[model samples]
Target: MTRVLVTGAKGQLGSDLKELSVHLQNIKFTFIDIDELDITSTEAISDFFSGQVFDYLINSAAYTAVDKAESDKETAFQVNAEAINSLISVIRKSQTKFIHISTDYVFSGDHNIPYTEDFQVNPQSTYGKSKLKGEEYVLQYENGMIIRTAWLYSSYGQNFVKSILKKGREKEELKVVNDQLGSPTYSGHLAKAILDIINKDMDNSIPFKPEIFHFTNAGVCSWFDFALKIKELAYLPCRILPVSTEQYPLPAKRPAYSVLSKEKIISKYKINIPDWKTGLKDCLGKLGELR
Candidate 1:
């Protein structure tokens, strides 16, 4: 059996992975959140790894409060960057494959085209910078694999989809920013992709390679487009208006164009990616909000 350790078991991606794990074969998952293990403490990680050995460690824990990270930079780096260093220090001797989840915020989002893996990263927010630091630590590890994703949402947690669903039903009109463009990733789909990679590696269908990869649902749209689609799908009779980013000022600056290119992961893993709309529909169905 393949022993896999998944951190951030309470988050959307981790939860999705746990739910999906039940249907798979020859894999035993040990899910832990901060309550079970404090990743920020190097001694804590060392002690945890003392008795247990895992074939793979899937790190999904992160400081994802984008606007809040502007003021709480220390906590953000501690969780996002320092914790990764701690994990690497302990896992180095065990030779465990480390799969870390990252965000599209690592880019400046100034381009008109999709972001490739090798594009020069220029993060514009505190959250992005901190995540980038974590990526640096992971890159230094010979066994590390970084999967950068964007606009993640799921049925299990608080996300844009749930937020829009709630407000769209209660409010008569809504205004969303039209300038920011990116792809929406359903955490369920991402969870499946992760498991697919792990299974392929274990079965020798495709050997595991330590490299950065991008994963997201196909197609791109702005926040306004996203909200409009949500309203349409939920059958909410609300007027949705599109506004510029300037109209809605946020504490943390978001990438205007952070759509990640899926060519590398798709071709290398031979995984079929669903369109964003399809993902959204499935997610809504899971939430029992699909009309």
Candidate 2:
């Protein structure tokens, strides 16, 4: 059996991975949140890896407070950048195949075309910079693969989808920025993609390559388009007012156009990426089940 260690087990993506692991007959998963493992401490990671070995390490843990990262630089860097070094050390020692999750924020959003993996990264925010640093650290290990996604949401965590549903149910009107462009990635889809890669590796169908890849739902849309779809899917009678980024200012600057190119990942893995509308519908349906 393939022994896998997933960090940030309670996170949206990590939770989805754990949920799917039940049906993976050939894989044995060990899930751990920060409470069970402090990834910032090298000693802790070294001690933990010394006891047991894992075939793969999926690092879904991250400091995702985008707006708060501006003021909380220390915590963000600790978790996003510095802590990654600790994981890298342990991954090297155990010869584990490392899979790290990154963000589309690494781009400056200055391009009119979709951002590709080889695009020059110029992150505009502290969060983006920190995540880029973490990507750099993981890339040092040739066995590690970095997957960058955008606008992630899931039933297990608080995200834009749930927030829109909640506010759409309570408020009569909601204003969403129309200038920001990206794709909404369902955590469940991403989790399945990750597992698919591991499965192929296990069967020797494809050799695991240490490279950066972009994984998001098929199409792109602005925040306004996303909100309208959310309200329609949830059957909520709420007016979604489209607004510009200038009208609503945030503490952290966001990418105006961060649509990632899926050409590379699609050709390499032969994965079928779902459309944004389809992904949203599936996520909302799962959310309804819980309520």
Candidate 3:
């Protein structure tokens, strides 16, 4: 049986992957989080992987607090950068493949056009910088897929989608930024796509062009547009007021146009990405189950 180990087992993406584990065939899974596994501790990871032989390591662990990351860069680096390096050191020796989840924030987002794989990275946020380092660590291993996704959310964990639904119920109006652009990547959808890549065993012997590819549901919108759709779907009695980035400032800067092109990932994997709006509606229908 193929053994697949997923870090950040309790996160939005990890939780969704756990839910789907029931239907996966010929796989024994080990899902670990900070509690079960302290990835920051090199000794801990060295000891853990030393005894186990996992076919794949799906790394979902990260320091996701955008504003907090500005001040807590050390913590972010420990988890996002060092932790990844630790795992890569061990996994590089094994035949196991890696599927590292990354963010679109790694790019500068200055371009109004969709960001292709070859696009240069000039991250403006601490979170983005840390994640980029993690990407580099994963890329060191030739047999790995550093899947870069943006604006991720699911019917699980603390996420923008759930946060909006929660606040929308309490507030009469919500202010959202209209400047930043990206796609909403439902965690379940992204997880499924990654698993498909492993299951199909896509050959990378052919020199893959821009090994780093963008993944988001079809179509794109600004944060303001996303909030509006969420309110509409949930039927929340709240007015989503669109505003500029200046209206809502944070400690960490965000990409003004971080939209990424999915043409490569789609053509390679043939993934059928649903629109974020469609994903939101379905996820909202199960919001009660999320908590």
Candidate 4:
């Protein structure tokens, strides 16, 4: 059996992985959140890994409070960057394949085209910088792999979809920034993709390689487009208005064009990625809000 350790078990991606694991055969998962392990402390990780061995470690834990990260940079770096450093140091001796989830924020929103894996990154936000640092740390491990994703949401947690639904129901109109553009990825789909890679590796269909890959739902849309779709799918009577990013100032700078190129992951893993609309509909159905 393939023993997999998934951190951030309570997070959106981690929770989705846990739900999907039930039907998976020949794999045993050990899911743990911050309560179960303090990844920031090197000693804690060393002690935790000393007792058990895992074939894989999927790290879905992160500090994702984008706006709050502007002020709480210390906590963000500690959780996002320092924690990976500790994990890599402790797992250096183990043969565990480390799969770490990263964000699209690592790139500056200055491009008009989809960012390839080798795109020169210039993160504009503190959160992005910290995540990039974590990516650097993961690169030190020979068996480490990084999967950078964008605009992640799920039925299990608070996300843009749920937020828009709530605000749409309570307000007559909602203003969403139209300037920012990226793919809206459903956590469930990402979880399945991760598992597919692992299963293929186990079966020797696709050998595991330490490299960065991008995964997001197909197509691109702005925040306004996302909100409009959410309102339409949920049967909410709210007017969704498009506004410029300048009009809706946020503490953290979002990528104007962070649409990641999925060509590498798609061709390499042969993973079928659904369109963003389909993913949104699935998520709404799971939330019991789909019309």
Candidate 5:
């Protein structure tokens, strides 16, 4: 069995990965949250990895508080950048296949076209810069895969979709930014992709080449459109008004156009990515079940 070490075990993506792992009998997963293993402490992580033999390290641990990262830059860098370097150090010694999860925030969103894997990155926020630093570390090793996703949400965590559902049910009206454009990635879908990568490698279905790839739901839309869909699907009688970025200011400046190109991942892995609308509906259905 392929042993996999999954960090951030309690996170939405990690939780989904764990839930999906039940079906993959050939893979053994060791899930660890920050509480169980402090990622920022190099000594702690180093000691933990020294005793275990893992074939793959799925690093989902990150500092994702976008606006809060502005004030807590130290913590953000420690978890997202410094800790990543520390983890890579241990993984290098263990000869583990590192799979680092990254974000679309690494771009400045100044382009009108979709961001390709080769696009020059220009992070505009502290969080983005820190994540970019982590990605840099992963690339320096040159033996792992880096997957960058955007607008991630799932039933297990606090996210835009959940926030919309909560507020839409509470308040009668809400204003969302229509200028910002990107793809929404459901954590469950991403988890499946991760497992599929491992399965493909085991079966020799596709030649495993470690490189940066973008994975998001197939289509793109503005935040306003996403919110409207959420409201509609959740059966919330909320009025969603379309607004500009300038109208609703945030501490962290978001990408105006950060839709990632999936051509690379799609062709390479031959994985069929669901559309944003379809993913959203499925997510809402899952949420409904929890309620």
Candidate 6:
């Protein structure tokens, strides 16, 4: 069996991948949440990797408290940067294939067009910088892939979808940024796509190195537009006021437009990753199971 280790297994993506394990073949998974495995500790990493071997390591663990990250950069770098460095060193010796999850924050959202893998990265915040460093470390590894995804949400964790639904019910109106634009990726969709890519292409020429690939649901929308859809689908009576990024200023300087280009991932994997609205409906339909 090809043993796969998914770190941060309790997180949204990790949990989604865990759910995906049901339909998998020939690959066995070992999920380690923070309690089971601490990625920040070298001693723990050493002990874990020394005892059990894995063919692939999917790092979904991250210091993802975005607003809190602005205040706790050291902790963020420790988990997002230094800890990833440790994982790379260990995985390198085992010659393991690593799939490091990263964010779209690496790019400055100044561009009007969709962000591409080859585009210049100009992160505007500490969180973005730290995640970019994590990407750099994984990219340094020869047999690794740094997948950059954005606007993610799921049932297992604190995400935009849940937040919107919660707040919409509580309040008569909500203010979401109309300026920021990106695909609202349901975590399960990306999880399935990543697994499919690995299942199909583990052997050939090994296409890209530390190869940065963008994966998100098909199509695009602003935060305001996204919230409107959420309200409509969930049958909530909430008036959404589309505001600029300035109106709802956050500690993090998220790019105005971080919509990642999916042509590479879509074409290479030949998987029909659906639109955000379609995926959202599936997720909501199963919201009971999710709950």
Once fitted onto the true fold, the runs of candidate 6 whose alpha carbons sit more than 4 angstroms away are 202-209, 289-291
Q: Clashes in model 6: which pairs? A: none
Per-candidate TM-score against the hidden true structure: 0.99, 0.98, 0.94, 0.99, 0.97, 0.95
All-Cα superposition RMSD per candidate = 0.7, 1.3, 2.5, 0.8, 1.4, 2.0
The model with the greater lDDT, 4 or 6, is: 4
Quote the RMSD, in angstroms, for model 6.
Answer: 2.0
How would you encode candidate 4's per-residue C-alpha lDDT over 39-152 as one tens digit per residue? 887778888998799999999999999999999999999999999988987777786899999989999988999999999989999999999999999998999999999999
- Between candidates 2 and 3, the lDDT winner: 2
Query: Candidate 5 on 1-291: residue-level lDDT in tens?
Result: 889989999999999999999998888889999888999998898788777889888999999999999999999999999998999888887678889999999999989889999999999999999999999999988568899999999979899999998898899899999999999989999999988887887788874567999999989899999998887777778899999999999899898998999999998889999998888887888878222
Q: Is candidate 2 or candidate 5 better by lDDT?
A: 2
Candidate 3's residue-wise lDDT over 1-291, tens digit each?
Answer: 889999999998899899888888678889999998899999989889877888788899888998999999999989988898889888888857888889988999889999888789888999999999998887787767788899999888988898888899999989999988888888888888877776776334333222776788878898899988887777778888889999898999999987889999888877888888777776776775222
The all-Cα superposition gives candidate 3 an RMSD in Å to the true structure of: 2.5
Residue 49 deviation, candidate 4, in Å? 1.2
Poorest 10 consecutive residues by lDDT, candidate 5: 282-291
A best-first ranking of the candidates according to their lDDT comes to: 1, 4, 2, 5, 6, 3
Candidate 6, residue 47: lDDT? 89
Q: In every candidate, how many clashes are there? A: 0, 0, 0, 0, 0, 0
CA deviation > 4 Å runs, candidate 5: 289-291
lDDT scores in order? 0.95, 0.92, 0.85, 0.94, 0.90, 0.87
Off by over 4 Å in 2: 289-291
Itemize residue pairs with steric clashes in candidate 4: none
Q: What is the C-alpha lDDT profile of model 1 across 1-291, one tens digit per residue?
A: 889999999999999999999998799999999998999988889889998999999999999999999999999999999999999989999899999999899999999999999999999999999999999999999999999999999999899999999898898999999999999999999999999999999999998888999999999999999999999999988899999989999999999998999999999999999999999999999999999
Model 6 lDDT-worst window of ten: 201-210
**Candidate 2 structure quality by residue, lDDT tens digits, 5-86:** 9999999999999999999988899999889898888788888888799999999999999999999998899999999988
Off by over 4 Å in 3: 202-210, 288-291
